[model samples]
Target: MHPDRYHVTLVLAGRPALHGWWGSEPIARAQFTGLVGRYGQPGTRITLVDEETGATLTEWPETS
Candidate 1:
């Protein structure tokens, strides 16, 4: 079992606003997209990461 290997976080004003953990990446990715549409805004950040690999899978307001 993966055991919550995927993490989703929503940050606002440089503080943690929401957090989620899932054992599946697909589910976590879907939640990430939902969070962006629901809470996406200036000074807000949302990210999905694979905790097991320590890799950032995706983030809102993408960086160059």
Candidate 2:
């Protein structure tokens, strides 16, 4: 994987449903959307955070 790529994961019930790396910020949204589209369902909530900064970026509903 490239150095800039980041692996984002969706954990459901303490288990991971999806995991992949995003190359850049622009792709983060699309990558997140795709992962959510595949694994997100009713009552599905996601927590987005930065591993390096230990900051909580965004946390909300994962489904449309």
Candidate 3:
């Protein structure tokens, strides 16, 4: 399995504040939820991306 294939990021005030990488999608998704709950506020953005395919898995405050 590819190591750190899933990338998660938390952006605060238009800057990257936190990030993580996981090989498992499930684990990355679960952590994404936690990050949202813990940092879900105005001006903060949370995202999960699949590094293998460069596809966005999910994001908080999704774009319209």
Candidate 4:
């Protein structure tokens, strides 16, 4: 991970799903999408957050 890159936190129901840094938002979103595709549950809530700011970047299930 680069020091200048944004850190991403992937969570499912408040538990850590994945963690890493990405050079750009698109790459982070792509990573999030892939993770959900692999480990997402039918009713589970998955979220992507900006680790530095604690802001939610995205969520799974569209309506979640």
Candidate 5:
């Protein structure tokens, strides 16, 4: 796996977030979408980041 790729950080209240990395944006988004579709609720947030620079790439529900 590339060191510089999109990753998902799942935020849950009163619990540590689960982190996973993907090889590309599309795959990451798909995985995240599927996860949220199955288990996410209000206040659940999906964070996307760049593994190499540690920069936050995007956040779900607010694509801007």
Candidate 6:
């Protein structure tokens, strides 16, 4: 992870990895990882829909 660049990466337990571009802060990444870790092995999926355009942005899968 680069301190100067902003990115979000989600490691799924039994699924593929997901990466996103956002504010690349260590704290941000850590927080996200922590949140996901609390849930258990990442196999859960989430669909992020754009309310205005009704478009899907990204789908996240839980990881172990």
Clashes of each: 0, 0, 0, 0, 0, 10
Model 6 Cα shift for residue 9 (angstroms): 18
lDDT of 4 by residue, 2-59 (tens): 4425555556666776677776778877877887788677646666666666677787
Each prediction's Cα lDDT score?
0.94, 0.60, 0.96, 0.68, 0.75, 0.46
**Reference-based TM-score of each model:** 0.95, 0.56, 0.95, 0.58, 0.65, 0.30
Using TM-score as the measure, name the better of candidate 4 and candidate 6: 4
Cα-lDDT of candidate 5: 0.75
lDDT of 3 by residue, 1-64 (tens): 7999999999999999999999999999999999999999999999999999999999998988
Output the better candidate (3/5) by lDDT.
Answer: 3
Q: After superposition, how far is residue 27 of candidate 2 from its true place, in Å?
A: 0.8
lDDT of 6 by residue, 1-64 (tens): 3332444445455554654443434454564555455543546543333333445544445324
CA shift at 45, candidate 3, in angstroms?
Answer: 0.6
Question: Alpha-carbon error at 11 in model 2, in Å?
Answer: 1.2
lDDT of 2 by residue, 9-30 (tens): 6777767666655556557667
Better of 1 and 5 by lDDT: 1
After superposition on all CA atoms, what RMSD does each candidate show versus the true structure?
A: 0.8, 4.1, 0.6, 3.4, 2.7, 10.2
**lDDT for each residue of candidate 1 in 1-64, tens digit (9 for 90 to 100):** 5879999999998999999999988889999999999999999999999988899999998988
**Model 4 worst lDDT window (10 residues):** 1-10
Evaluate model 5: give its TM-score.
0.65
Q: Mind giving the per-residue lDDT tens digits that candidate 5 earns over 1-64?
A: 6843888878877464788888887888787787677657776787778787788777666655
Candidate 3 regions with alpha-carbon error over 4 angstroms: none
TM-score winner: 3
Q: Which regions of candidate 5 fall more than 4 Å away from where they truly are? A: 1-4, 52-55
